[model samples]
Target: MDAMQMALPIVGIVAAAAVTFYAVSFAEIREKSFEDLEDKDFESGGFKPSFSSRQRRARRKADKEGRK
Candidate 1:
C-alpha cells in the first residue's frame, strides 16, 4: 500500500506532463505572412523540387538518350 501511494503520484505527474506536451504541440499558431518576399522569389518556384521529382527527370532523360 505504501508503494502504491508513491507510484500513484508519479504516474499522475507523468500523465499530466504528457497531456501538456501534446496540447502545446498541436495548438493553433498564426501562419507567417509572405508580404516580405520579392518578385524574384515568386518567379522561381517557392520551394525546391523534391528528390523524387529530380530522380524522375533524370530517368526520363536517360530513357530518351537510350532510345536515340
Candidate 2:
C-alpha cells in the first residue's frame, strides 16, 4: 500500500477516539442553573468601608496609642 493509504487509517482512528472522549466528557458535565438566592440579614448591620476610610481609621488608632 502507498504512504497515504497506510496513514489514512491511523489518522481516522485517532480522530474517532478524540471525538468519543469529547462527547463522553461533555455528557458528564452537569448543568447548574437552578440554585436559590442567598438570604440577607438586615438586622445584622454590616458596614462596607472604603479603602481610604480604613487606612485613616488605622492611622488614627496608631497615633492615639503611640501618644499614650
Candidate 3:
C-alpha cells in the first residue's frame, strides 16, 4: 500500500510533464505557420506559388514551341 501511494504521485508528475512538453511543442509549431503568412501581403491575394501550375505552364510552353 505504501509503495503504491508513492508511485501514484510520481506517475502524476510524469504525466503532467509530458502534457506540458507536448503543449509547448504544438504552440511553437502553430506560431511558425502564422509567422510565415504574416511575412506575405495578404491584401494582394498573397503570391503563393504552386508546383503544379509551374509544371503545367512549362509543359504548355514546350508544346507550343515544338509545334513551331
Q: Number of the top candidate by lDDT? A: 3
Clashing pairs in 3: none
- Given candidate 3, what's the lDDT at residue 11? 100
Q: Write the per-residue lDDT of candidate 3 for residues 1-68, one digit (tens) a residue.
A: 69999999999999999999999999999999889878999669896666698899999999999999
Residue 1 C-alpha lDDT in model 2: 75
Compose the digit string of candidate 1's lDDT tens values, residues 1-68: 69999999999999999999887766632112333333236446774535698899999999999999
TM-score of 3: 0.57
After superposing candidate 1, which stretches have Cα over 4 Å from the reference? Answer: 28-68
Task: State the lDDT at 18 in candidate 2.
Answer: 100
What are the lDDT scores of the predictions, listed in order? Answer: 0.72, 0.72, 0.92
Considering lDDT, which of the candidate structures 2 and 3 is the better prediction for this target? 3
The 10-residue segment of model 2 with minimum total lDDT is 30-39
- Cα lDDT for residue 36, model 2? 17
